[model samples]
Target: MARVSQAHLDARRRQILDGARRCFTRNGFHATSMQDVFKETGLSSGAVYRYFRGKNELIRAVAEEAFDRMRLAFESAGREAPLRPLDEVIDGVLTRALEEQARRAGTDRPGAFAELILQVWSETLRDESLAATLHALYDRMRVMWVVVVRTYQDAGHLRADVPADHVVRVLMALIQGFIVQRAVFKDVGGELSSGLRALLSPEADPHYRG
Candidate 1:
């Protein structure tokens, strides 16, 4: 009998996710079929169905996987000793995210998670559950940033006149807007850190003590 241990089970789950990600990247969420994933994974119909009840379940898992990656990316950036000030740190983090996202670009079949994330963002508007899930992820990310911003406020480093919470909100909004804008229009091009600061505050430079 084939031994099904925890490692094996996890491997199967990752296999399905990897396969779905590739197929989703190639065909998009709306067009991809479960049969496509099965073909990609080399899993039997029954075997694939045993792990995922349906496509929705598979997509949700894929989304969770994507979110996990983004969360780690941001959190790790926050922990790194920044070479610049608070605002610069925020800018730099986004700079990295944009760089990574841009690297993820290329209509030439990037990966399933790329289009998957975009589709989820678009579909969240029509699907209440998906919207709620996306909102929760956003909230968590914002909260993490709030802590980072608060550090500057406490140090009397950030602008005293402006609410730290507002700065946090601005940072998050800039990240989201830049990602969406870049995805939709490939025109805005430059170093993301510099671009983000300029986009967030056209008149102000992040290097200046505020």
Candidate 2:
């Protein structure tokens, strides 16, 4: 038998992962079976099993790949000499996320990736291993956010009095809320950047009677 090159092997692995992502996006983590993955990839059960033991392993691989891309995005953004504005960073991330989701779903429709993330969140509720994987990834992401918050604080774009960690949590919440809204509602009117600016503004409305 002719030996397969490492490049070919890697491509095959990616093919399986892409197929699994589509399956999970469409049918969700719980409903997608290994057989479904096999059909999706046009690979035999043995071929799919060679890369993943089961659906859980495939799910882990898919989730990690998604998070890894996000980590890289944050790392890239942090490399700017003077970090970009918070709103710009958030908007860029959101745009990239939607584009990635569209590519994964093989459709231009919004929220495909958001729906996949929601499915993963639901799965984590019952799967301790998945939950741990996500928790560790989130912690690492939060560390990135801490760096971002401190940069903004140093630049006087954000309040220096507030704890960086607290700011990080709120930033994380904003992104999470964006994901939830996109996944459930599909049409989240208004730019996230605009909403963020309104919240962060120091001036109060004169019309408020409270």
Candidate 3:
């Protein structure tokens, strides 16, 4: 019998993760079973178990994948050529995120991405290990956002009156609020995108005299 190649193994893992994502999205983490994941993937029990030992492990992997995607999006916003306007950077990030969500929606996974994130948040409340892991990831993300925000401040786009940490905290709160609202109330994408740009724009603040 031939052994599976590394590429094949990686592909199989992604397949399992995708199925797990859908299952958790449709049914909350506590309600989703390994059988549901197996059914979602259309894979044999043995194949599913080979990738994830149980639902807990599968959910953790799903959470990691979600945050990794978010991290990439945030990093991209900070990396435009010649430094675009702060509002434009924010719009770029929001547009990419919403586009990805729409791509999932096109596949009959409408709102599943955001739903899965809410599922993770609920799971974190009851799972100490998962909570710690996600806390660390959020901390790292906060640090990244600080860098992004400070970069803008240094570029004279954002006000220096607010500390980077404070600014990032408010931004993160707005983002989380938008995600929750978008998940529950469909069609808020346009409003949320516009709000993000407006909130981050320099014009939102009266010119600081200090």
Candidate 4:
């Protein structure tokens, strides 16, 4: 048999995962089956199975992909350090996530990630291992954010009085709230960047020109 290229193998694996994402997006995690993935990929059962052992494995992969996007955003902010404003950094992450999610949605319907996240959360409730996996990803992201916040505090950009972890949590809460609101409600009027900036500090008003 001819040897397959690594790039080809990676592409095939991604194809399977992408198909699985669409299936899970359309049918919820529990409702989606290996057969569903097979249909989605238009490949033989053996081909899909070769990449993923079963539906559970596929679900884990899909969920990991979703979580990684958010994690990278946090890590990117951390790398930027004191140079980037906390609110702007966070808004950049949120904006990128929303844009990528909307593009992946392949539809005009807003809140695609919001709806998919709810489905993942429901699955996590039933699956302890999955829940643990998600928790680990979250904890890692939290640590990254805390470091970023502390860096800003040291630079006198953010208040040093508040605990770094506490500030990170509040900022995360705002992002989460934004995700939920943007996904559920169609018209989330007002500038999210300005709102997030104001949340970071009262002096965050964007309109001041002096």
Best-performing candidate as measured by TM-score: 2
Ranking by lDDT: 2, 4, 3, 1
Candidate 3 off by > 4 Å: 101-110
Q: lDDT tens string, model 3, 62-100?
A: 888777777788787777622776656665675576557
In terms of lDDT, the best-performing candidate is 2
Per-residue lDDT over 1-210 for candidate 4, one digit per residue giving the tens place of the 0 to 100 score: 999999999999988988887777676777888888888889999998888898888888788788888798779767988897777888787777766765564544446666676677777878888899999988999988888888988887777777999988888778777777776785663467888777667245364222
> How would you order the candidates by TM-score, starting with the best?
2, 3, 4, 1
Find the 10 residues in a row with the least total lDDT in model 2: 201-210
For every candidate in turn, the CA RMSD to the true structure comes to 3.9, 3.5, 2.4, 3.9
TM-scores for all candidates: the values are 0.79, 0.91, 0.87, 0.85
Whole-model lDDT for model 1 versus the true structure? 0.67
How well is each residue in 1-210 modelled by candidate 1, as lDDT tens digits?
977899989888878877887776667788989889889899998988989998888877777667766876777776643334654665555556545543443234222233456787887777787777778887888888777666655555555456667887877776666656555665544555666555444236556464
Model 3 has an lDDT value of 0.76
lDDT (C-alpha) at residue 146 in model 4: 88
Q: Relative to the true structure, how large is the alpha-carbon lDDT of every model?
A: 0.67, 0.81, 0.76, 0.78
Q: How much does candidate 2 score in TM-score?
A: 0.91
